[model samples]
Target: MPVVPVGRSADNAVTTSPQRQRPTIAIVGAGIAGLAAAWELVAGPDSQGGDGPEVVVLESSDRIGGKLRSTEFAGRNVDLAADAFLAQRPEATGLCDELDLTGELVPVGASGASIWARGRLRPMPEGLSLGVPTRSWWPFYRSGILSTGESLRVATDLVVPHRGTVGVTGDRSVGDIVGERLGRPIVERLVDPLIGGIHAGGVDDLSAAATFPQLIAASRQSGSLLRQLGRARVPAPRSAAPPPLFWSLRGTTASLAVALAGALARRGVAVHTGVSVDAVERAGPAGANGATHPSWTIALGGSGPPPTGAVVMADGTSSLRVDGVVLAAPAREAAVLLGPLAPVAAGLLSAVEYASVALVTLAFDPGAIRSPLHGTGFLVPRISTFDGRPALITGCTYLGRKWPHLARPGDELLRVSVGRFGDSRPAGLDDDELTAAVFAELTRLLDIVGTPVETMVTRWNGAFPQYRVGHLDRVARIEQSVAELGGVAVAGATYRGVGIPACIGSGQTAARLVLESLSAGADPAGRSPGRVDPTR
Candidate 1:
């Protein structure tokens, strides 16, 4: 392996002169968050009208996008993971507007979805706030998702007055609060399937403060929990139609990452894939004068030979020296890198757990369907059973119906999700067996007749970071410890949020911290950086 040293080209030729030397910022991952961080470093307000910092992105995998990926299936680009992002968040849309991709954005065509309840597929109750019905009686009674007894139990929230203000006092699990107010039936049938499905973990231990802070505020009110949540909702203009709940790109959601990577290349940002970072160590002694920040040396390893002009060490390892770094890798990888520098941050990161999931895309003939496929698809509650045992399938999406671009005249495309935190059933089955099992469940759920024409299975292991109780406090401590290192910052799903928008915001914030340190020569106060305005 050859080492590509700083200030040198791939052919061992000097690229930048000593007179034109500039600060170099290294981003440790090439995922969406890392890419967003690189963007903020070069394209943000601080970089405009001047020579920007030299930015380089390193990724371990053969590809750039982490869990955001797509493939050519059934002659169209189909997402194997998340297919859309929440439209209410501005980070994703704001970044797309800057990338000249605003015209390619597409809104969801379908609305509403079903939940498997009482051994049948029933429409989700209207006026739901994250699976907790805001309107107490009519919607639940009409949908019939809950039994007559369960429906009456929910109605009690309207008349019953809870004693304590536990929600506002401190951190608590989502299930603990919802079940206490709305009854256990709602938690098992609605809350777990929706909220739990989002994190790929049971909400019984999921953090309410981190995931849904609004729930806490609503719970503090004295009146009905249902009415309180209804009042808490942000109302749209009375005359205007409500905006789309989610958005996706024309080709695939993964195009956002690809487009961002190309934009980075055009701006002279070097993005290297298939390279693993072995360690991050202090480069040398601190600078002279009033400088308190220390530079860093990053060790690199890969299967291929090192790029020419790299500083190959005596041990045959390549290394690069950068003034600052954005550690945007996952929690496990971040923990390993921070162990030597910030042990507290490393230990906190190590404690953050992740969940694995698998997406199975199947194409069926239009004639095989027995019931009209309503809405986008349906979700299976954790308590649901099939074949006299717990169901392995969690949810399913009608790809062709939801995204008209992927529709075919004779083909009905469906994407089924399997596996969640603490569920090992999907892991035990091979591709063929898993596909068959999912198909069998679908046959009963959708009343299908024949086999699928084509099938594909994609697995994402440890993709979702579980936000357990007290997650936000833990994140605060982690950031404080990393800030003490002066020029180092952490970003990605593990800290703030897991959605595309949240991850993008996380990356941009980290970039701002690095920029501040680089400009001031050091961050002595170890203060938390403010969020970069998405509009800016």
Candidate 2:
């Protein structure tokens, strides 16, 4: 494999000739998904044309990393959004291995978290799978999140006759399934807070298959969620405990993106930031390589098409012809690009909804809060209300306590999350208002006094995509429709799953789909006989 020179040639056309030209692919949106796709294309075995096809990553934003950004505060590196990834998920950890970042992987400091429930902070129940009590009845009964009666009702699930196959094959809301088996109290008090925190939406509207596939799989295996969990549980050995469930790069999440960007540069992959793709379409019958597949023209912010032997350029906006495209932007962004070419898949992408959230990170005097900030911060139950008003703060992460590397003696860093589905108040509030509201609540919740030494409020609008019931089916339809287009594919938080690992997996999958079509000499304007399944 050899390095490929990047950028447009002297005549403003792609440098390679049709006879020996390598296929070029464009990746839109330089988030984790797009970067991961590029990594797979350049670093994976399938990459052709010396090391790989000429790759170009276009980012709408001035920088990359999207939600995986980190900033320095309180004399330590702090993640503005997600701090870590599930170590059990092979994609994220696997990508780290490929990047030679395994040495920097550090496990989370402390494991368990607490919940503010029933007018008090209570420890979360132990041995629970996503808040479904599994090992014993005592944990749930004592956790105080659920009433004693509710705990007993949940325990009865072990002997309760298996319900009809609602979740056996089809889909159901997480709230519906959990409520039916364990009662409303467990669903509202326990499951809703934990799962809802992840999606920033109500569990009643979240897809059981997409959100809690383990529970669905368990339901099929044992007919009872509780029984299946119990049977699956492996007690910790007395002599040694298990490893941490989550891990992060020691340099912070943003460092991973920085490293990846550096790797792309070294591989001669052209990455252009602050470039918005207005639209994408099939250019003609053949690509720069004179192949049926990979012939696509991207409309830039400027107007008009590129002249023959010259890439379109107007007011710093230029259109580039490519062999294949990976639409790794947000669901809505992707829909806008795909609407003109593949309306069915565009509609499905449009149907995928999103939830916005705000993270208010404050650096407060260590002496201001007297209470022992135990564990990782705490989650606010969806049902929780303050002053007869809904709880404004969704959850809080005690940065210093949760990760020892960020610990400092004089002050503490607290990241408070606000907003969720059906809750538009936080979104409407100004940053100052949001900070004040969150600060007041934090003071009350943590028995803190005085003001913060510093504050930073980061709002992620439409950052989380809501995976409603039948989400998997919807994704399949979207993929099928995209596949029919031959050279175009989509990947992001909108499909399959929304976590870091899931997004990475989707990107890698999308890259393969597009490359396979290109390599097979498939048609770009119509359905291809050699289109590959993204799931495989």
Q: Among these predicted structures, which one has the highest TM-score?
A: 1
- Model 1, residue 439: distance off in Å is 0.8
Query: Which regions of candidate 1 deviate over 4 angstroms?
Result: 1-21, 163-168, 285-292, 304-310, 523-536
Question: lDDT of all the models against the reference?
Answer: 0.84, 0.80
lDDT of model 2 at position 108: 83
Task: State the TM-score for model 2.
Answer: 0.91
lDDT of 1 at 343: 78
Give the TM-scores of the predictions, in the order they appear: 0.93, 0.91
lDDT of 2: 0.80
* TM-score of candidate 1 to 2 decimals: 0.93
lDDT of 1: 0.84
lDDT of 1 by residue, 55-97 (tens): 8899888888887889999899998888999899999999999
Model 1 / residue 483 / CA error / Å: 0.9
Which 10 successive residues of model 1 have the least lDDT summed? 527-536
